[model samples]
Target: MAYTAPLLNKPAEGWKHDLPGPNQPPTRTPNTRLLPNPPNYVDDIYLELPRSTLAIRSVGIWAAVIFFLTSTVAPVLLIDFTVTEGHLPPFVLNFFGLVLLSTFLWIGVYLWRMDTEAPRDEPIRFNRLRRKVYVYRFFHDGAKPFSRTAWGVRPVAYDWDDLHAEACSLYGPMGTGGFIETVTLAVLKPGTHEVIDRFLFTHEIHRGEMYWAMAQLFMQQGPHALPTFPYVPRDWNNEDVSFNLARRLAPKVVWPAEMDLESRTAP
Candidate 1:
C-alpha cells in the first residue's frame, strides 16, 4: 500500500511543500536547479540548511586566499626574524615555514570539506514505504528535480532507528536595520542526551510550520520516525532576545499540543 502524505491528500510537485495551501502544484516549475527527475517513490520532502552552488564554491576560493596570504607572509616573517637576525639556523626558518604551511593547509582542507553539497549529503531523508531510514549522503536522486543541484554522490541507507530532534535559531539586525536569521535541527541520540546529527535550515522565516511538519513526519506511522521538537531551544547569545520575537512568529501548522507548552508561552 502506498502511504499518502499524512494530513494532506495531495502529491507535492517536485519538493515544493507549501504547507496548508490548496492541493495543487505551483503554476510552473521552479527556476532553481533540481535533480533532473525525482522518482515516484519519495514523499514528504523536507529540506534543511539548503545552500546555493555559488555559496558552496566560495569555500574553495576563501580557502585558497587564506592559504595564499599565509604562505606568502609566514615564510617571510619567519625568515626575517630568525635567519635575518642570525638567531636560528637557516634550516630552522625553512622548517618553521613548512610547519606553518602544513598546519594552515590542514585547516583549510577541513573547512572546505564541511560543505555537504560537495559530498552530496541530505542530512536526513525518509522512505515511508520501505520502512528504512535514508541517510544524508546515501540515497539515489530518484530522478526528481532537486531543491539544489547535487554534487552527484548518491544517498545511502542510515543505520539508525530515529533522530531525536531539537532546533536552535536566531534573528538579529543585519546592521542595516534588517534582520538576518538561521535555524538548525539537531538529531540527537535516542537516550543519554547526545547530539548525533544536525540538519541546518538557513534563512527560513517560518520556524513553527517547519517544526510541526517535521514532528508530524517523525510521529507518522512506520518503523521509523524523526524525533519531535520538545521546546524552542533558547538562544542566550541574544542579549535582546525578546526583540521582534512576537512580530516575527510563524503560524502553527501541526499538533501544537505535543510541543513544549512551557516554552510556547514565553516571550
Candidate 2:
C-alpha cells in the first residue's frame, strides 16, 4: 500500500551525555603495573663481568717479551758454549729448553687471555673517536698466590648502522669448563673491525642472541622487517606482537621509541 520510513530510537541517558568540558583532562587510572622502557642502541648496554681474572694485554706483552728475548739472545749466548766445549753445554741446552717453553707459554697466554677477558657485568664503553670497544677484566695470578690481574680489550668498532643482527649463546654444559659466554653483533663485513676479532673470540651462542635482539630494538631504523621468532610471520600490522617479543627478549634494555615523545622531539 504505502511506503513508510522507520523511526530511530534515541541513545540511552549516559551514552549521549556531554563529555566533561574540553578544559577538563580525561581521568587517569593509576597504572599499578610497571612497564619496561624500549631498547636504545645509542644508550649504553651494561654487560656483567665474568668470573675469570686474567689481564690479556699485560699477559700478551709479557709473552711477547719472553718470546723475543729467548729467540734472539739464546743463540748468541750459546755461541760461547759451542766454541769452548765443541758442543752446547748442559746449561746451554737448558736455555734452549727455556726458549721452546717460552714460545708455547706465549701461545697459551694468548688463548688464556681471550678466555678470561670476555666482558661480563660491566659497561662496555664504545669510543667513537678511536672506533673501538674497551672493557675491563680481572684475571688470577697463579705464581703470586693472592694476586689478581686486570686487563682491557681493543675491539674494532663497526658503525651501529652496519650491525645486521646479534645473538647470545652458552658454549658448554653448566658447571663444566667452558669459554666465557659471548654476544656477537653480526656485521656486514669481516675486516670492518679487525682488532676485536683478532683478540677476542666474539662468536658465542647466547651473547649473539642478546646482541641481535638489542641491536634490532636500538639500532635499526624505521619499522622492523623480520619477526623476532620463526613461527611469527613478518607483518608491520602486527606491531603488538613485535613489540612484545622484543620486550620479552631484553627486559632491561630500552629502545628509542619508548622514550618520552617530548624528549625525542627536543631540539
Candidate 3:
C-alpha cells in the first residue's frame, strides 16, 4: 500500500514515557545550531522553522544521470537485441522505447515538480503563547510518480500538549547500507495512544533530540534561555545567497490568511 503523509497509526508499543514539558530539559543536548536553513522568525511569540531539503544542484545531478543512462544503456540494449535476434521487429523496438521513455518521463516529472513548483519552504510554527503548533505540510501522492494529484503545502494546527516525538527508521532495499532516519512529532488523542496526525520534526536522527529540546526551551523559558545562535539567520524574503539559484524559481512561502493570523497571536 502507498504511504501518505499525516500518518494515522497507533503509537509504536514500547516502554514509552511522557516527553518533558516546558522549563524541563530535553533528553538530547540542545543547541542553537541552525545552519543551511534557519528559522524565518524566532521571537517570544513563535518560532518558525523551514523544512524543505532538496536544492537546485540536486536536480541538475539527477538530470545528468538520466541523460547518461538513456544515451549509453538504451543504445547498448538495442544493439544487443539486434545481434541476438538477427532481425528486430519494429513493434518490439517501439514497445521497448515506449516503456523506457515512460519510465524516465515519470521520474523526471516527479523531480521537476518537487524542485521548481513546490513551496520554497514548508515552515512549522510553534506558537508558545497559544500553546499550539502549526505545520505547513507538503502534500503529494507518495506511491505514484505519475499521479496527477495536486502537490502543494497544507497547513494544520494542533495543541502542543498532544504532540510526541517518535524516532523512525527506513532500511534500504533487502536491508542494504542505505538507511534513512527521521523523527516524527505525533499528535495523540488525549489520554490515549492513538496517533491522529503526525509531522516530521527532523531528518537527522542524531540531532532530533537536540532540536526537540530547543523547541521546548523556547516555548517554556522564552528566547532568553536559549543558547547563542551559531550563524546569522538567513533573510529568506530578501537577498539570501545560501539558497541555490533554482530556489528563486520556486513558489514563495505564503500561509493562509486565517491560519497566519491565528498562529502569530494569542487568543
Best by TM-score: 3
TM-score of each: 0.39, 0.29, 0.75
lDDT top scorer: 3
Give the TM-score comparing model 2 with the true structure, all chains together.
0.29
Model 2 lDDT per residue over 1-267, tens place = 111321112211112111111122222221212111122123232211121122222344445446555564555656776798797668758667677766655555554443434332222323232233333322333343222343343223344333322222344543666644443333334334222221121334333333334323322322242123223222222224342332222112122342222123312
Cα lDDT over the full model 1: 0.36
Q: Write the per-residue lDDT of candidate 3 for residues 71-182, one digit (tens) a residue.
A: 4555567778888889774787767776776676666666666666566677788899998999888776535755666676778898887787766666644335776666
Mind sharing the TM-score for model 1? Answer: 0.39
Candidate 3 lands at a TM-score of: 0.75
Sorted by lDDT, highest first, which candidate order results? 3, 1, 2
- Model 1 over residues 148-224: C-alpha lDDT tens digits? 34324333443233332222334443455644333333343454335555444323424423433443443253223
lDDT (CA) per prediction:
0.36, 0.33, 0.67
- Cα misplacement distance, residue 162 of candidate 1 (Å): 2.3
Return the number of clashes found in candidate 3. 0
Candidate 2 lDDT score relative to the true structure: 0.33
